[model samples]
Target: MTGPVVRKCPLCGKPRSAEHAPFCSTRCKDRDLMRWLDDGYALPGPPALDEEEGKA
Candidate 1:
């Protein structure tokens, strides 16, 4: 088999830690969560209309 591939952290580009898996540390994890809560990330698609609004 080949050597194990090292995965870099998504936030800081540092080597990933076992405890945090994809994230390098607690701070990065919290930062990702905050981004989600603050709407820093968004799904790509057309706006979705409510059922009643669609009928109108």
Candidate 2:
């Protein structure tokens, strides 16, 4: 099956067009940058659930 459609910019929920396939506009793209600078996004790690730890 074909992969899911590419997403638009997170800051502005708009369809990805040819001019800005990923981001609707430069402003939206920059907004994502601001979020990174402000540490607004975080990559969650997997929970530590080892079998050995449970045994203890």
Which predicted model would earn the best lDDT? 1
Q: How close is candidate 1 to the true structure, as a TM-score?
A: 0.77
Clash-forming residue pairs, model 2:
none
Worst 10 residues of 1 by lDDT: 47-56
Q: Write the per-residue lDDT of candidate 1 for residues 1-56, one digit (tens) a residue.
A: 99999999999999999999799999999999999999999999998999989994
Provide the overall lDDT of each model, using Cα atoms, as 2-decimal numbers: 0.94, 0.77
Q: Write the per-residue lDDT of candidate 2 for residues 1-47, one digit (tens) a residue.
A: 99888776656778766685578887777788899899898889987
Cα lDDT for residue 47, candidate 2: 75
Query: CA shift at 23, candidate 2, in angstroms?
Result: 0.7
What's the TM-score of each model vs. the native?
0.77, 0.53
Give candidate 2 misplaced runs (Cα > 4 Å): 1-7, 46-56
